[model samples]
Target: MGTADAFHSSRTHHAAQGAAISELVDRKFAGRTFGGSIRRRLQVRSHDGPSTDAGRKARQAILLVPEHEGEASSIMCGWLDASRRVAELRPFSSVRTSHKTRFGSEIDLPEAEYEAATEALRVYLSLQAFEITFEVPVEPSGRLPRPRRLSSAAEVPASAPEARASESWGLIVLAALVGFSVCYLLVLLGVIG
Candidate 1:
């Protein structure tokens, strides 16, 4: 095969492998809760701004959390790819926490829960011929907080319902002010009371 043809074939194979891995991981842990203190977190997010903006990328991440209230322990894995022009993903829950800290408190997951997730992923990866294994420490050494970042004005869609609603209200207020001003000027000139 030509060099270019070989490269294309390899890329396609890798993409298919990645998709299979993602699907398997999500099915195993997407919504299951453990000991009422943990839940599987599989979040896929993307950003496709104006075509002129070449820095935009799509994101996919999976996190396993053992706690959500007070202190917490978690695991996270993610990757980025070129934009496919997809809709953005929003959080499944909108509930706010009482803590006002700048960062989350990280702690070790109970040995049982930690081992369960690690072993499951390791076995699946091997079965897929992906010679990879988790190298986690004896203790949970990473803090996997929910990712957050600010978006530029250009990144926010003007067609969003919230944005359109606020804009419509602003125009109505401006029209009201103009109408009131005209009435006041007419009264001053004795054109009308």
Candidate 2:
């Protein structure tokens, strides 16, 4: 393959590997005394304004923890420690932490710094027996929203009694059909003739 093709292929491979590792970590530590695994992708943009191409970077990381091991406050503290370590390693970026009652806590850092911190966090978690993995993006500024519980389609609103009634009717129809089929079969076999 050509150089460009090879590069693209390698990038795709790397991304796939990262996703697979994330899935494995999630499966291995999702339950059983382990809090779920979290996969995060963050964007680092120029703090100056919205439409500025001055400096931007992107980073991604995954972390796993025991279920309820650390509450919000403790997680924030750990994030602060991780950010500080990242800053120590790479002094090129500024890192800030914010805590809001509604939004929880967040650590905003430069892309490079974020990547470094994520690596540091991964290592630290490993030592602490928590599984984690991370990857740095070639192009910066790609943000992924934190996962949250979403209402399933199966969920019905309290006001949607009509829909519920329809579902019940369908179930009744299904039961009637099954009953009819069983009776017909019995008659055909001379068992209930």
Candidate 3:
């Protein structure tokens, strides 16, 4: 085979092996993938846009742009092709093309995988937060608390009956036992403690 053919063959092999971050593209997968179909991420995302003048105002985080300028078109095609191949191999799902994108790429899966992907994404995003804290806002909005008068027991209708305070009798009994124990201990000390 010619050198170009050999290169393409090697790229194909690499794409198959590397899977989600398909080696053919030489661009890191920008995530939000993995309903087991990886094609949809080949986006010129909002970040990758200066697709218009206003987009240029924002400093964007560009990811998944291929390594070399000359190979951009081929790499994009190869990346997409590889994604479709990977999508076809998904055990529990198949590629669904119904949902479209301006980027002209979509790799959806069966409904089952689509459901599971939400949880997978949740876990994925959760782990992405290395540090978490309830820090205050940089500039606090000084706002008054809105007073909401809670509904009285008398106002509750027969439908969806309000929970009776008497339902906590077991807890009250437990508290009484604890209180009795404390009283008994104090009395035993002979100081009416």
Candidate 4:
């Protein structure tokens, strides 16, 4: 195959393999992209053995591509799409937060929560042509919840009959090819005459 064709075929094969594995795990996979800029911050707090001490907070902002004007909507859409995927991957709880914007929207989330959500959004946005800034709080126990099973049907495996039929068809094709090759060899050797 040509280079492009080979690349396409390889991509398809990889996707199929991924789908097969995801199916076993009862998960669905989706991809997205963003185009603009992103900024993130993380905060952490340590409670001192029930003492009334306020938690620690850290703020960070990242500015990428200072010249991509008039692309905010595209960037927002990509971020939302990626956020949805993160929601799917960790289906246990909603990571919805309010953002505070001087003239736009307000997003408010805890440091760990925002980190998980923004990580997914960042991946999707990176697929597009935009800049990104990510600030994540370092929490040793912070992790996205495991993806839940969407339905009981998704948990079930294929039926035995279907699997048997597939195997039988494969064997039949192999036997037919082998038989045809043996006959062709005999004909070439004049043994069948």
Using TM-score as the measure, the top candidate is 1
Model 4 steric clash pairs: 34-125, 98-106, 98-107, 98-108, 99-106, 99-107, 99-108, 100-106, 100-107
lDDT of 1 by residue, 1-193 (tens): 9975564454443243334455665666666554334443443222222221332222334455443544453444323222221122212111111111223443233445544554555565446543332222222233544444423432445346578899999999999999999999999999996
Error of 4 at 172 (Å): 19
Collision count for each candidate, in order: 0, 6, 0, 9
Model 4, global lDDT: 0.33
Tens-place lDDT digits, model 2, residues 1-193: 9975554454433233333344444554444231123333221111122211211111123332223434422222121112111211222121222222235444322344445545544554455444332222112233533543323321233336678889999999999999999999999999996
Q: How close is candidate 3 to the true structure, as a TM-score?
A: 0.20
| TM-score to native of every candidate shown | 0.34, 0.22, 0.20, 0.20
Cα lDDT tens digits for candidate 4, 1-193: 7974554454433233332332322221122222213432211111112211111111111111112345331111111111111111211122222122233463332345434544654554345422443223223344644554433422223254478789999999999999999999999999997
Q: Which pairs clash in the backbone of model 1? A: none
lDDT of 4 at 184: 97
Candidate 1 shows a clash count of 0
lDDT over C-alpha atoms for residue 67 of model 2: 33
Candidate with better lDDT, 3 vs 4: 4
Give per-model CA RMSD: 17.9, 21.0, 20.7, 18.4
CA-lDDT, candidates in order: 0.42, 0.36, 0.33, 0.33
Better of 1 and 2 by TM-score: 1
Question: For candidate 4, which ten residues in a row score worst on lDDT?
Answer: 52-61
